[model samples]
Target chain A: MASSSEPSALPTLLVFRVRELRFLAALRERYRVLDFFTSGSPLAAFLAAAAGGADPPRALVTVGGDSVRVDAALLDAVPSLRFVHSTGAGLDHIDLGECARRGVGVASSGTVYSTDVADHAVGLLVDVLRRVSAADRFVRRGLWPLHGDYPLGSKLGGKRVGIIGLGNIGTLIAKRLAAFGCVICYSSRKPKESVSYWYFPSVHDLASESDVLVVACALTRETRHIVNKDVLAALGKDGVVVNIGRGPNIDEAELVAALKEGRIAGASLDVFDKEPKVPAELFSMDNVVLTHHVAVFTTESRSDLRDVTISNLEAFFAGRPLLNPVLHS
Target chain B: MASSSEPSALPTLLVFRVRELRFLAALRERYRVLDFFTSGSPLAAFLAAAAGGADPPRALVTVGGDSVRVDAALLDAVPSLRFVHSTGAGLDHIDLGECARRGVGVASSGTVYSTDVADHAVGLLVDVLRRVSAADRFVRRGLWPLHGDYPLGSKLGGKRVGIIGLGNIGTLIAKRLAAFGCVICYSSRKPKESVSYWYFPSVHDLASESDVLVVACALTRETRHIVNKDVLAALGKDGVVVNIGRGPNIDEAELVAALKEGRIAGASLDVFDKEPKVPAELFSMDNVVLTHHVAVFTTESRSDLRDVTISNLEAFFAGRPLLNPVLHS
Candidate 1:
C-alpha cells in the first residue's frame, strides 16, 4: 500500500508462491502488486503473466520450491529484475551465481526467524534432556514411573552444547542456552570472529566433545549428512542431537539406527527430509521429539516477517540497500 | 553416616514411605537405619521400630508419611531426641507445636528442589503453550493434517505471569521466566519486605489480570483448593494454568470442565490428588501436560539434595545449629 502523502514510485512486484500472503497483502499500497497463485510450478505461469503486462516488474519474490535449478529458469523469465527476494531463510534455491553474474540483487529473510528457531532449539533441548515428551505421555497413560517408586530424570544445566554452523540462529540459541547456564561450543567451516566459544575445526571432534550437538547450519553439498554414521558413532552414548536447520544435515536412517542401538541418547527434529513423512520408528521411540516445520509461524513473527519483507522491498525500489542480501556461494 | 574422624552422633533414620525410603537410602553413610515394612499402617510400624531400639539417636528424620502426626508417640519412644529433620521441603507433617514445646529443634530441606521445580515449570509452560505433546502425537499417528496446518502457538515473551506463592521455588521460577522477557506479578499472604514485582492482594485479582497463572504455594488449610472454579473462571479463555505445588490447589473437576469447554487454554500439572490415578477424561486431551511429581528428581538436584541433607545432619550432631531450621507452623 502506498502512502497517500508520498505517491509510491514503487515498481510492480510479482509475488508468486508466497506462504506468508497476509504479510505481503499489507504492502499493496507501497507497490503496484501482481500476486500469481502457483504452488510448485510458478515458472511457466509467471512468464505468461509478465509477458501480458505493459511493463515487467523490476523485482520478483518467490519461495524455495524445487532446488536452485528452478530459480535459474525464474532468472531467465524476469530479465528486468533488479532484485529478487527469496521468502525462505536458507537460499538453497535461487542460483546465486546466476544473479551475481547478471548484477541482479537477491535478498532472503535472514534473522527474521532467528528468535523463533532459537526458542524451538531450547524447547527440543529440554524436551529430550528432561524427557518431557515421554513424561507427558506417561502421565496420560496412567504409567507415571517416578510415582510408581522409580525416579530417574536429568536437567540441562551444566551440560556442554556443540553447535554446527554458528550463524544467526545458532548465535541466538547460544545466548539463550547461556542464560540457562550451559557451556557453549561450536564447529563451523571457520570460527566466527564475534563469538568466543570453543571452536572445533571438524564435526567429528565436536560430536565427540559435546554433551549435546545442535545442527543450525545451512544445508549445502558440504553439510549434507555431516552428522552421518561416523558422526553419530563419535557422539557416543550420552549425547543428544537437536536439529533445526535442515534434515539432510543428519542422516535420518543412521540416526534411527543409532537411537535404536543406543549409540546416541536422543534427538529432537523440527525439519525432516520429507515433510509429513517421518518414520514410524521415530514415533514409537522415547528419545525422539518431532515438530512439523512450524518454527517460524508464531503469531508475532508472522506479522513482523511480513513488515520486514515489505521494508526490504521498499528499500530496494527506493534505491536503498536491502536488509539481508543473499550471498552467492 | 559419619567419617572416621567425625563424631557419630548423627541420627539413625527410620523411613516409612516410598519417597522417604528413596531419599534416606541415597545418603552416603550408613546410620543405624530401620525400614518399615507395612502396607496399610506405615506409621504404626515406624512407632514399633522406634520403640524397640535399645538406645535413642541424637535425631529422627521423616519424609512424607503418617509419621508426622505420630510425633508424640515417636518422642515418647525416643526420649533422647534433640532434633527432627523432614526430608520434604514443607514441614506441615511435623507436629511443630509439640516439637517447640518439647524443646526439640526441627529442620527441613529448604530450596534444594527450587531449581528442579522451576525447570519443570518452564518445561511445562513451553510444552502447553506450544502444544508440543499434541503436535508430537499427531505426527506419530500418521495423522499429520493434510495441509500441515494446525492451531497457531503463542510466544512466552511479553506475556504476564502470575505466581500464587513467592517462596523459594516461586522466586527461582520468576528469575528464570524473566530471562524470557515476561512480566512477573505475584500474590502471597505476606508480601516480602523488599522485592520489585507487581503484587496482587488476592488470587482472583491475580487470575483476572495475568495471562498465565502458576500455583507454587504450599498445600495448607488456607491454600487447599484456593484455585477453585471461581479462580479458574477469573483467568478467562486465553489463560494457561501451571501447578507444580500440589493438585488440590486446583479443583480437578472444575479444571477439566474449563479446559474441555475452552474456558481456559490449557494446564500443566506435576502433582495429583491420587498418585498414579490420573482421570481417564484427561488422557486423550492435548491441552494438558502431566507429570508424576518427579520435578524434584533431577540428577543435579538429587545429588545436591543428598549432600545438603547429610551436611545438615552432620552439623546438628556436631553441636552446630541446623542450616534450615523448621519453625512451628
Candidate 2:
C-alpha cells in the first residue's frame, strides 16, 4: 500500500498481471505495483477502491498476447488514468481511437523487437523454401533410412519475393534476402521513396510476379485479409507464403483451401486467425510449417521490451515525452 | 552403342546410372550415353566392351550424393578416361589425387550451389535459435492450445557467429548474417586475405567465442571430426552449432553426448556421420534440428549443376579447358 502521508512515496502502477518475475521486480523498484488480476479481489471492488483513494494510480501497464481488452467502459472506471503502456509492438488489442478521444497517451515497445521479428520471418521463409521443418519431421520419424531421398525443395536465390508491407520489419527482411541473391519487391500503402525495391500498387499484382509472398503488415480494416483468395490465386501453384504479421492480415480459410488443393505451393505461418487453435488440416501437410505466435518472444527481445516499457512509464510519471509514443491519426 | 564407322560421331559418356531423366535427355543430345547399371551388364564385361571399342568413352559424368566411389581401381579400368565431372561441389567420392596423377581433368559444380547452401545454413541457424522446428512439432502435437504458451527462444542479432571454413559457402553465409547484425568470425585452414572478418587458427578458440558455430568445410582426413569433444566443451552451455558441410565434420557421438547432457544449448545438423542413419538419441531431443543432407538439393541448383556438368563434358570432348577445374595439391 502506498502511503498518502509520505510525500516521498512512489506512485502506484496498476497491472492486470505480471508474467516475468524480473520485469515485476524492476517495476517494483520504481513504483508500488498493484496486480488486479492476481490479487484475487473482485474487479468491481478493486476499481471502486482505486477510484476512492486520495492518490489513485495514474498509469496502467500490461503485457501483450493475452487478448486483454481495454475498452471505453473500463477506461470510465479508472478516471485518474492518463497513460497506458503495452510491453509489445502490436497495438491490435488496444483501442487506439478510444484512447485518443479520451486524451490518454499510449506507448508500445517500438522497433525493439523488429530485428527479432524480421529474423523469424526470414527463418520461416527459408524453412518453407528449403523444407527445414518438414525434413526435421521426416528425420525424426525415422523415415530417412526407410525412404531413400527426401523430396527436393525450391531454392531461395533468384526467386522473386514480394513483401506485403515495407515497414521496419519488412525492410530488414528485404535487406537480408538480397544478400542471398533474391529479387525483392513490395506492395505497401504507397511507395517508400528511400528504397529502390520495385513496388506494386496492389498485392494481387505483387503476388502474380512473386515466387514467395511474405505478409508483415499491421492489422487494420484496410489491411485485414489483404492476402485473400485473389492474391493466393495470383501467387499460383509454385508460390510460397510466409506470415509473421497478425493472423487476420491473411484469410486463414482461403489459405487452408489453397494449400489443400495445391493452388499455392506452401505456407509458413507464425500467427493464426485464432492462435493456439490452428486448422487441423495444416497438421498433416508436409509443405506447411506452423508455429505459435512467437515472432517477438525471444529472451533478448523480452529484456529490451521490459526496459522500453519501464522507461515509457517512468517518462509518463515524470512529465517527460514517451520513448515510443503511438501517435493517433 | 557408338558406331566406330563414323569418324565425326559424338564421343561416348559412361555413367553408372541416369537418375534424372532431364539430365539424361540433355546429355544424350551431345554424346553417346552409356549407362552400365541400367543396361544390366556385368561390371567386367561392360568395362571390357567400353575399353575394347575403337571410339572408347573419353569422359565420365555422375550425379552427386550417391557415394558412387571413383577410386583407383575404377580409374584403372577406364584407361581411356580423359575427364571426370561431378554434378556437385563435393569431391570426396572422387579420388582427386589419383585423377591428378593420371592426368585426368576433374570438374565440379563450383559456386552454382553456394547461394542455396548458404541459405539452408542460415535457415537452420535461425530455426535452432528461434525454435522454429521445435515449435512446429509442438503445434502439430496439439500442445499450443493445451500448454498455453510455448517457451521463448534466443535472438540471432548481436550474437557472435563462428564459421569453421571461410570457403565460397561460408563467405556467403557471413555476408547474409551480417545483414542481420550478427558479429561474424571464422576458423579455416588459413586466414583469407581479401575479407576483414576476424580469424582464429584453432576450432577450440573459435567455439569459445562463438554463440553459434557453422561447419562448412570439405571432408578430409585432417578435417574429419574437427568439432570434437574439446571444441564442444569450449562452446559451453549457450552455444549452438549448424553443420551444412559433409558428414563427420563434427564427432557424432560426442555431439550427441553433449546435447543430451545439456553441455551445449542446441544444434541444427543437415549432415551426419552416416547418410540416412541419424542417431536415434537425436530424434527425441527438442534442442536439435535434423535434415536428410539436403543443403544443396534444390530444384534450381540441380538445373545449374546439370548445365555445369554438361559444359565440362563438352569442353573435355572438344579439347577445350574445363570450366571449373579442381586443382590437386
- Against the reference, the lDDT scores of all candidates come to 0.76, 0.87
lDDT of each residue in B97-215, candidate 1, tens digit only: 77888888887888887777887887788778777767777787777646555776677778899999999889888877776667999999977767798999899999999999999
Tell me, by lDDT, which candidate is best.
Answer: 2
Candidate 2, residue B315: lDDT? 73
TM-score of chain B of each: 0.86, 0.93
Clashes of each: 6, 0
- TM-score of predicted chain B, candidate 2: 0.93
Q: Per-residue CA lDDT of candidate 2, range A53-125, in tens?
A: 7678888887555645666876788878888898756788788888899888898888998989999999999
The C-alpha interface RMSD of every prediction is: 2.0, 0.7
lDDT of 1 by residue, A120-156 (tens): 7777887777878888777776666344544456776
Among all windows of ten consecutive residues in candidate 1 chain A, which has the lowest summed lDDT?
A1-10
Candidate 1 TM-score versus the reference: 0.86
Provide candidate 1's TM-score on chain A.
0.87
True contacts kept of each: 0.55, 0.97
Tens digit per residue, CA lDDT, model 2, B1-329:
43334455777888766577898889878877777756667777777778777778888876555645777888888898878887766888888888889888888888988988999999999999999999999999999889556679999888999999999999999999999999999999899999999999999999999999999998888889999999999999999999999878899899999999999999999999888799999989888999988888899888988888888777777777888988421
